[model samples]
Target: MSNKNPSTTRIVELAKQKSFNTEKKVLDTIKSMIKNKKVINYNTVAKESTVSKSFLYKNTSIRKKIDMIRNEQADLKNVTNHKGNTSDKSKDVIIESLKFKIERLEKEKQELKDALAAKYNDFYNNL
Candidate 1:
């Protein structure tokens, strides 16, 4: 007969059940995250899934999955960064357009001022 106490066996069984449930929960959480196209990283997964970072890092399978997904995302991130740089070019274009507008407005103001002065001179001469 096994020498283990009954209570000890019961406690061990409970611990095993809890561990299995936790593993399942973490796996399901990851699958759903992938489905939803959410960002997957150690910090994000830990925070979103309400699990400890150590737990995710410690589990061999989960660790591998996280590493693979993170690696794939790094490539996508580079592409996004490249697109975002166009904002700087757009800013330059906007600035040039505004400068052109200001120059045109200033010319119009000067013409109006000259016309006003000519009208005043004519009025005084006629008086």
Candidate 2:
């Protein structure tokens, strides 16, 4: 039981009018989804705008861009992890350097004390 509506077909035809190029329409659709804060499907856009789903997809497929974005995010995560590891390595190096400096200072102090005792004994015998 379909109602005979003449204006419905006309309305659908107007909706199918190409005011913008295929790529621009796809980009606009992406922006609209973001503005509405929801995900939209290409098939739905096709139903609304009367453009074929295959054609829309062929013109504005974001698979490559999405892949690149994912790769970039992974790289960022790796860099952050590397920086943390480097910081830990730097702290270890600093701790080792301070320990070496302390040991060297202690050895020098002991040498000076021994030299002073030897000099004092020789002077007392001579006097």
Candidate 3:
């Protein structure tokens, strides 16, 4: 009477049943397949588990975990780059400060020489 294909609908129902098991069996199977290099792609995982790709996409916790891992990797790269820049800047600042101090010390040395020469005429006369 209705538009239902009973056999086709029954297969679909069985596949859907495999998609939502409360036991750890489904996740464990997925992990084992990954470990054995059997399920290679998301499509394969979906097919093997009889789950839809849309189901994986809709799981907010799994999506958030993936995002967090990516964010942490990016943060690590940024910190490494920042450290390199800071190290270079610190070296430049140290070199500039040393150069300034050297110039100041040379100026003081010249001034002291001039003052001594002026204060002692006999020193110059004896020489």
- Against the true structure, whose TM-score is highest? 1
Models sorted by lDDT, best on top? 1, 2, 3
lDDT against the true structure, each candidate: 0.88, 0.64, 0.63
Query: Tens digit of lDDT per residue, candidate 3, span 14-63?
Result: 87676545123435545676577462344665566666667655655434
Model 2 ranges off by over 4 Å = 1-86
Q: Residue-wise lDDT of candidate 1 within 1-127, one digit each (tens)?
A: 8757555778899998987788788888888998998989989888877889998998898899999998888888887764445687798987899999999999999999999999999999999
What is the clash tally of candidate 3?
0
TM-score of each: 0.58, 0.32, 0.30
| Better structure of 1 and 3 per TM-score | 1
Question: What lDDT tens digits, residue by residue, belong to model 2 across residues 1-127?
Answer: 8768655877776656753465566566655754664434555556544567776656535434323544665676678664444587798988899999999999999999999999999999999
Clashing pairs in 3: none
Q: Please estimate how well model 3 matches the true structure, expressed as its whole-model Cα lDDT.
A: 0.63
- Residue 28 displacement (Å), model 1: 1.3
